[model samples]
Target: MPGRLQHKSALITGAGSGIGLESALLFAAEGAHVLLVDVNLAAAERAARLVAERSPGVQAAAFKADVSKEAEVKAAVDQAVALFGRLDVMFNNAGIMHPADDNALNTEERIWDLTMAVNLKGVWWGCKYAILAMRANPTDAARGLHTGGSIINTASFVAIMGAATPQLAYTASKGAVLAMTRELAMVHAREGIRLNSICPGPLKTPLLMDFLNTEEKRERRLVHLPMGRFGEAIEIAKGALFLASDDSSYMTGTDFKVDGGLTSCYVTPQGEQVLPPPASLI
Candidate 1:
């Protein structure tokens, strides 16, 4: 049988590491030609090599692009089309959680500006260009492909709930992503483009691990998680895959939360330990 995303093309941002890198691998494994975009060209290239090694014969390439810069983002999208013939999925997954991004009063202007530039404005640019490309996507009858595609933006559980350890700018920027994704989905629904935001909970990714460095800091947050542990990047990548594929054909403008039940719990239950080991691609 053919893979779920066989013959489709995908472009993933921040493909150097974390959720982005894992998604690139998963997309390629599922037979989607993938273009991994990152500001760090070497990192992206390394990820592309991993794709080739792990999923041989799958088309995977790397490009250098800073999602915060519109020109670079546009160029990356163009490169995906040039290499893969069409853009079937756009994962706007590049973002930053600045170390100094504390509460509203403590966070500096530069930190807030930088977070929004990458997390909010970057997502906007990705959506803008991806929609344009998907609009003109050529029908590939042989591959069962057609115009329109899926756009998955990475938001956070913090976008819907408050965090006591406040990364104010990071939280705010994600909230904006959810909002922007909803409006864009509405605007492009008729055109066959589907837009949705995937809201992940606190994860064990480097981005959050660096912030929750101290044991005290980590415990402070872990106590609230019903799962009694942080999430993994591959878990989020699995959610992105669903949004990218035809499995979610009827879904659009949804705030798809793969948040380990963080947004729903008041007090986590304590019981026998049987949690599955975290998934990885490295």
Candidate 2:
């Protein structure tokens, strides 16, 4: 039997050293022709090499493009279609959290501007181009169904829940992503295009760790984690896989929070189970 995404083509931005890279590898393993895109050519190349090592015949390639630029993003998607016949999955996963982005009062103007440019506007460009591509081929002749594709935007749990240690700009940009995703999902529902956002919690990615290099920084964020640990990049990649595959054909406009139970918790971890112990039936 073929893999879940057999014969499909996927373009994943931020496909360098974290969740995006892991997802590229996993998608290739499942038989999608993966296009590994990133701002760093070297990083994207490294990821492409890894995918090739696993599946030599796979049409995996790498492209360097800053997601913040409309032309670069459009060109990347066009390149993927040229190489792989169609763009089946467009994963707009590129993003940044500037070190200076704290609460609104403390965050600098530059930081706020940069965050919206890359996170919010970048995702908008991806969706715009992907929709244009998908619209051209709305019905899969083989399946005899609407053949539009999946557009997965990387939002954050912070978009849904307020953070006390506010990366105000980051949180705000992700919130816009969720809202845009829902609107796009509604507009394109009949066009067969499914749009959704992945609202991930604090993962142990370079984007998070580079700022929190000190143990104190780590603990300050980790204490609130209900799982009591930072999630691995691969763990989040699995969620992307489900969204990309046909298994989630009915899913759209949904914000899938892969936050290790953090969003549901009423209290932060105090290095122990602080909740009252289950009452004994005496």
Candidate 3:
């Protein structure tokens, strides 16, 4: 049987590590040609190699692009189109949670600006260029391909709920992504383009692990999780896959939360011993 994303092409930002890298692998496994974009060219190249090793015959390449810079983002999108002939999925998954990003008062102007540049403005540029490419996408009747495509932005559960240990800039940037994605989805719905934000909860990714360095810091966030543990990047990648494929063809302008039930609870249940085993690339 053919894969869900058979014959499609996808461009994924921040494909060096974390959710971005995992999603690229999954998308390729599902039969999509993938371009892994990242500011770090070496890491992106490494990820592309992994995709090639894991999914033989699937096309995967690496490009260095800083999503905050419109020119670079446009270049990356153009590269994807050049390599794959059309852009079918754009996953704007590159983002940063700076160590200096704390509460409103403690966070510096530089930190907030940097976070917004990468997290908010980055998603904007990704969507803008991808939409333009998708609009001109050529039909491949024999392969069942057509114009317009899916766009998935990485938001966060913090956008919907308050965090006691506030990364104010990070939270605010994600909230903006949620709003921006919704409006874009509405504007492009008539053109067959679907846009949605994937809100992930606190995860054990290097980004969050660096922030929650101390046991107390980790526990502070963990106590509230109904699952009693942090989430894994692969879990979020699965959610992105659904959004990218025709499986979610009817969905648009939605906050698709794979948040480990974080947004739904005021107080989490206690005394659970067994939990779902974490998924990883290895």
Candidate 4:
């Protein structure tokens, strides 16, 4: 059977591991020719190889690029279009968490700058070139079979709500992402380009797991979660699939919260939990 992204070409940044890797594989499985971009060439190559090995006939390639750099981001977009004829989607997923020592009063200037460069400027750079590439096809005839494109930026739940413990730079950067998405969506809405942001909550990724290695920290995060468990990479990928596919054709300048109900309630009763409602509730 034909897949949701058949005949589309997608460029995903930060595809070295975690959600980026999972989403790249998922996009390829759904028939997208995926360009996996990462700072780690080896990891990107391995990811592409995994995609090719698992999904026969799916086009997959790896590129080493720092999304924070405009030249590198532009080149990646150019490479994707050159290889696949057009750029159908751009997933600006490259991001970093603040170091444990990062706090309001003690965060270093260098750390804050680095985090901003990768987390915020990176997405801006990705969107900048992705929009230029997507707009390359001025006419319907030149638009290729897919006709248009989509842009999805990775944001965090912290962008929406600030916690007592502050990763100052990370929180600030993500907040900017949410605002940028809306403006970009409006600017490109006429070009047949759509932009959206994915706000992921506490997820079970290597980065988070490593940070929460201590039982104390893990419980601290878990107690705030209504689901009482962290989300998987695949769950985030599914939300990404919606934004990347025609399924969300009319959606732009919107934020999807894939947080297991973390943002749904003001407060869950102290001892009670708010689970995904039963099947019948649907």
TM-score of each: 0.96, 0.93, 0.97, 0.92
Q: Report backbone clashes per prediction.
A: 0, 1, 0, 0
Model 1 over residues 1-282: C-alpha lDDT tens digits?
788899999999999999999999999999999999999999999999999899896899999999999999999999999998899999999999998999978999999999999999999999999999999999988988999999999999999987758799999999999999999999999998999999998888999999988998887787678888788899999999999999999999999999888899876756757465554433
Report the candidate with higher TM-score, 3 versus 4.
3
TM-score, prediction 2: 0.93
Best by TM-score: 3
Compared with the true structure, all predictions reach lDDT values of 0.93, 0.88, 0.95, 0.87
Alpha-carbon runs more than 4 Å astray in model 2: 138-140, 143-146, 273-282
Which one wins on lDDT? 3
TM-score of 4: 0.92
Candidate 1, lDDT over the whole model: 0.93
lDDT for residue 194 in candidate 3, whole number 0-100 = 99
Error of 3 at 151 (Å): 0.4
- Evaluate candidate 2 by giving its C-alpha RMSD to the native, one decimal: 5.3
Candidates sorted by lDDT, descending order?
Answer: 3, 1, 2, 4
TM-score, ranked from best to worst? 3, 1, 2, 4
- The alpha-carbon deviation from the true structure for residue 194 of candidate 4, after best TM-score superposition, in angstroms, is 0.2
User: At residue 23, what lDDT does model 2 achieve?
Assistant: 94
Badly placed stretches (over 4 Å) of model 4 are: 138-147, 267-282
